[model samples]
Target: MPVGYFVTGTDTGVGKTLTSCALLHAFAMAGKSAIGMKPIAAGCENGKWIDVERLVEASNVPAARELINPYALVQSIAPHIAARQTGIVINIATVQRAFKALQEMAEVVIVEGAGGFLVPLDDRYDSSDLARTLGLPVVLVVGLRLGCLNHALLTARAIHVSGLSLAGWVANQIDPHMESQAENIHTLQHRLNCPLLGVLPFSEKIAAREYASLLDITHL
Candidate 1:
């Protein structure tokens, strides 16, 4: 079976991309052929999708960029709005086809989601709907900071309601000075049934592949 995980976050700007990239680098370092996908990306600059470009670079195989990110919108907004801006409709089946193509050449595929679990993709399609269509387990990236307790549990609850397994979680320290960091971890460690895969410290001077060293993949 292809080793894969649908990477989601507690909320937007919660280091989901960083964790997804780390998984790609970690698996590659462990001698596994890894590939990653953003599938649907928002935030295009000058008509270029930056996040999609990043995932293209992270892949260990020779998959085409179009297969990695089949849906790209030019507006830097919610996917539904972004797709609507250009009269483009985001299709879940197209993304699934892209994923199937990527799987033929990689041992592990890490798929990163845009924004949050409930972010809308089209008139009726959301990230949660796409996750269900893919039928892959999830690895949530929890942004460790204030209000995280509520966000983490709520996201965990949402994932459960989505009917996918929460394979594990990564606690990303985006705010270094956030209060009671230890307690937050303890709370999540207790409330979340998945394993605490790793805890990353805040860093302003590190790249994703470099910051990936902090993760203990054995726990994953």
Candidate 2:
């Protein structure tokens, strides 16, 4: 059986890709054939692409970019807006196909959603919808900031409403200036019904590899 997970964030720029890559690396380090999927990517680099390129870089080289990021939008906006701009119809079927195909090649798969759980990809599809389609447990990336409690709670509720389980969560402290950050972590640990796989500090100097102890790769 292919072991897989869905990675969503409190919002865009919450280091979902970075966390996803770290999980991939963890699985690789554990001698498992790990793979990653972006499903959709926003924001572009160079003249041609998006964050999926970075995912491709971190993933096992054998998995093609097309396999990881099935949809790469050049426009840096909500996925629905990006889809409309490109006249692309983003939906569950397309993403599900990409996900299923990727599973055929690797034992462990990480599917990273483009933005927040409710950010629309189309009229009827969103990150939650895709996660439901994948039918895997979720690993939410909580961008530790002031309003994270609300965002994380809302996302957790939505995940529950979608009839799926949140496998675990990672707290990436994006706001170094956030006051009483430890309090927020304590609150989340008390409220969230899942494991806190990590509590990452805000740092420009710490490489992803240094935080290996922070992650719980046992689920992989």
Candidate 3:
């Protein structure tokens, strides 16, 4: 059977891409062939998708551009809006097809979701829908900050309601000076029904390969 995870976040800019890259690096360190899939990305610069490029760079397993990211929207905005502006209809079936192909090529495929768990891909489908379609366990990226507790709980609730398992969660310290960080993690540890994978300290630079060692892949 194919093994993989759907990496989602409590909200946007919560280090979802960073965590996904870390997973790829972690699996690589363990001698497992790993690949990262973006599926849908909003932002683009010079006709290149930054998140997709980052995932491709981090992955040990090489995959086709279309397979790694099926939807590369031009605008750096909500996926639905970007799609509409570019006359693109975000298709879940296309993403599913790409995922199946990736599964055949790699031992582990880490799929990174765009924006938040409930962000809409189109008028009908959202990130939650895509995660369910892939049937992969979810690893949430919680940006530790003032409103993290609420966002984390709500995102966890949505994942469960979608009938998918919350495999584990990572607390990315996006806020370096956030008060009582330990207490916040403790609260999430108590509230969430899954294991606390790891807590990453805030870093000015993205040391994904270094941070990869910090992730507890055993839980994954």
User: Could you tell me which residue pairs clash in candidate 1?
Assistant: none
Kindly provide the TM-score of model 1 when superposed on the true structure, using C-alpha atoms. Answer: 0.95
Q: Estimate, for each residue in 91-148, the C-alpha lDDT of model 1 and write its tens digit.
A: 9999999988888889898999999888998888799999999998989899988888
lDDT of 3 by residue, 1-220 (tens): 7699999999999999999999999999999999999999888898888889889999988989999989888878999999998899888999999999999999999999999999998888899999999999999999999999999999999999999999999999999999999999999999999998888889998888999989999987
| TM-score-sorted candidate list, best first | 3, 1, 2
lDDT of each: 0.86, 0.82, 0.94
Mark the regions of model 2 whose C-alpha exceeds 4 Å error after superposition.
Answer: 48-50
Sequence-dependent TM-score of model 3: 0.98
Task: Estimate, for each residue in 39-130, the C-alpha lDDT of model 2 and write its tens digit.
Answer: 88877878756456556666774776677777878888998998898898876787788788888888889888888988888887677888
Judging by TM-score against the true structure, name the best candidate.
Answer: 3
TM-score between model 2 and native: 0.94
Question: How many clashes show up in model 3?
Answer: 0
State TM-scores per candidate.
Answer: 0.95, 0.94, 0.98
